[model samples]
Target: MKFFDVFLKQFRLQWRQYLVASLASYGSLCTGMSMGWTSPVLPQLRGPNSPLPEQPTLQQESWIGSLLVLGGLIGPFITVPLSKHVGRRWLIMGSNVPLLLGWLLAGVTTNLPTLYVARLAWGCATAMQFATVPIYIGEIAEDKIRGALSAFFLLFINIGFLLAYAIGPFTSYWGLTACGGIISLLYLPFSWYLPETPFFLVFKGRLEEASSVLQQLRGKTKDEVQPELDSLQAMIAREYEEEPKISDLWASRGSVKALGICVFLAMLLQLSGIDVLLFYMEELLAKVGTKISPSDGTIIMGVVQVATSCVTPMVVDRLGRKLLMWTTSLGLTIFLTLIGVYALLDNYYKYDVTSVTFLPLLCLIVYMILFTLGVGPVPWILVAEMFPLKTKCLASGICSFMCWLAGFIWTRFFRDVAASYGIYTAFWILAVCCGIGFIFSVALLPETKGKTFDEIQDLLNNRTKQGNPGA
Candidate 1:
C-alpha cells in the first residue's frame, strides 16, 4: 500500500482509540506538571520573597519533592481493588478529584502541612493514572499500534513537564497552580465520555457492553467487531475461569516472569535518576554553573524532552522495544558519565573548565532526550503489554508502586548525597545505574513490539526459543 493510504486506513480504524487514549492521558499530563512543579517553585519558596509563611528549609523542600512519590505508594492498593469493581474508565475519571484538589490547595495554601497534603494528593492521583491509563490503552488499542498508544502515557507526561517548565518560570505561584487545577478540572468532563475498556467490561460480565465498546474502539460495525469480541471473551473466560486472586499474578511461569521483568524495569527507571533531574532541574543547572539561567535551562531541556518523547511513538514499533531500550540506556550511561566527570573536575578539582562550561547542560539536555526515548516510556508500556487481562491491574499497580518508591527514596536523599559527597557523586551513581540498565536491556529485556498478549506470554514462558524468535 502507498504510505499515505496505509496511514489513512490506520487512522480511520484507530482514531477513537487515539481520542480516548489522549483523553485518559491528560491525567498523565497533569501528573507531569505536578512532578515538574517543584523544579521552579521550590527555589522561589526558598527565596527572599517566599510565598509560604516562611522560607522552606532544605529538609522541607526535600519533603515537598519526595512526598509526591511517597503518596504513590498507596496508589496501587486503592486502584487495584477499585479498578476491578468501578472499572478502569471511572477510576481514571475519579483520579481527577485528587489532582484537582491537589492543585487547588497548592495554589492557595500558606502552611507547610497544607502544601504537603497537596503534594500527597498529586501523588495519589499520579499512582492512579499510572495504574489505569496504560492498561486501558493497552486493551483498547490494536496490537499493531498498542506500543504507540501505550507510549502516549509518557508522551503526554513530557508535554506536561514542558508546560510546567515553560509556565512555572513565568507565572506567579498561584498562577501556576491555577493552570494545573484548570487542566485537572477540564480533564474530568471529557473523561465521562470515554468508553470503558472492553477487557474490563467482559471481565465484569457486561458482554454486550464490551462488544459495543470494542466496536466503538475499532470503528467497526457490530458484525466486523464480532471476531475480536469473541477473542476477548475466550481470553477473559480462560483467564478468569477461577476467580482471579493476587496469587493469580504468578499462576503461570510466564505471568511470574512478566511481573518480575516489569518490577525490575520500574525500579531501574526511577533509580536511573530522572526524578533528581526533574525535581531539581533548576538547582542542578545552577550548581553546574551553566551560562544559561536555571529556569531557562529547564525550559530548554523540557523542550528537548517533549520533542524527543514525540519521536518514540513514531519509531517504537518500527525499531522494537529491546533495541530502543539498549540504545537509550547506553546513551544515558555515556551522557551521565560525561555530566559526572564535568561536575567532578569543575566542582572538586576547581579546574578552569570555562572552555567546556557548556558540557553539563549539553549532557543534561541529551540525557533528557535519550531518557524520553526509551527508559522513560518503555517500562510503562511493558507494564500494560506483558500481563494477562485477569491480573493486569494488580501487576501494573505493583510496578507503578515500585517505580514511585524508588523515585521517593532516590529524590529524597539526592540533596543529602550531593551535600555529603559531591554533586558528581550523584551523577556517577546514576551513570553506574544506567550502565547496569544497559546490561539488563541486552540480557533480560524481551521484545514485545507488535506481539499479541498470548504470543508475549508464550515468549516469556520460553515456549518458542529459536533465536528468541521474535527478538
Candidate 2:
C-alpha cells in the first residue's frame, strides 16, 4: 500500500516524464530481442531445419553470437560525436534503420555469411540504443525518480527477452524476424512524438525551448520550471567552461578515478556471465539436465528476469546503489558457486543426481532474480550518473566499448572453454568474478542514489569527504 502510494504520487507528479522515458526505453526492448534471438535460433540453425545451405561450424556459431558484440563496438563511436551534433532523440530514432535492416536481412538471408552480416547490423543498433537510452532518460527525469526511470531501460530489455523466449520456439524463422521488424516499426512512429530532452536543448543554447520542454516534462508552468531550467543552464555553463573534450576525462584525479570505477563496473557486468547466459541459456539448461525442456526453462528464466527487474525501479533510491550491488553480488557468488558444485558433482563425478535435478533450475531462477535486481541494471544507471554532461558521451562510449569487448571475448570463448574443461569450470569462473565484484563493492564503490551531478562530481573528485568505503 505504501509502495503504491508513492508510485501514484510520482505518477501524478511526473506522468509526462514517465511516458517519455518509457518510449526511449523501447529501444532497449529491441536490443533485448536481438540479444535473445541467438539462444532459440542457434539450436534451429545447427539442427536439421537450418535456413542456411550448410550448418555453421562451432567456430561460426561463436562468431554468430560474438559478432553482435563486435558490431556494438562501433556503436559508442557513432553515438559519441553524433549525439552532440544531432541530439539523443534523433540518434535514437536513426537506430531503427539498422535495427529494421538487420532483422529484415536475417529473415531473408539464405547463407551463413549473410546471416553473420545481419547479426552485426543488429548488434550496431543494440549498442546505439543502449548508449543513448540511459542518457536520454537520465537527462529528462527528476532526481527523485531518475533511478526508477533508468531501471525501466533494463526492465524493457528483459521484457524483450521474455518476448523472444516465449515466441521464438513456436515461430518460424521468418515469423520471428518479422516480429522484430514490426517492433522497430512501432518504435519509429511513436518515438517521433517524443520531446527533445531539455538538457540537450539547453546545451544547444535553446533555453526558451528547453523551458517549454521542461514544462511538458514536469507538468509545470514556465514559472514552476524556471528554477530547474536555470539549473540546467548553470550545469551546461559549468560543463562548457570545463571544455568537455575527451582529454577532460583524465584532466583531474577525480575524473580519472570516476572513469576507472565506471570501467571496472562495466567489465564486472559482462564478466559476471550475463552474455553467456543471454547467448546460451537454453544450452546451459540442457546441460543442467532439468526436468523441464530447455525452451521452457529459457522462457521461465526470461519471465523471472522481467519480474525481478521491476524491483530495482521501486527501491533503488530507497536502498541505494552500493547496498544493492553488495547484496546481489554476494547472492550471485553463492548461487553461481552452488551451480558450479552441482555441475562438478553431476558431470565430473558422474553422480546420479536425478532426485536433485531441481537444484540447477532453482539456483538459476534466484541468479536471474538477483542479477536483474542489481548487476543487470545498476551499472547502466551508474554510467548515466557518474560523469558530467561534457564528458558523458566520451565516458559512456568508452564504458560501452569496454563492456561489449569483454562480453565478446567471454561469449566467444565460453563454448571452447566449457568443451575443453567442464561446464563446471565455466560456472566456477563466473562465480569468482561475482566474488570479486562483491569485494569491489565493499572496498571502493561509491553511492549516488539521490545525488545531483555536482554532488556526484564532488564525491568522485574528493572535494567532499564520504565515509570510508572499507569501513
TM-score for all models, in order of appearance = 0.97, 0.97
Off by over 4 Å in 1: 1-9, 466-471
Count of clashes, each model: 0, 0
Error of 2 at 261 (Å): 0.9
Give lDDT for model 1.
0.87
Worst 10 residues of 1 by lDDT: 462-471
Error of 1 at 171 (Å): 1.7
TM-score of 1: 0.97
For candidate 2, the C-alpha RMSD (Å) to the true structure equals 1.7
What do the candidate models score in CA lDDT, each in turn?
Answer: 0.87, 0.88
Clashing pairs in 1: none
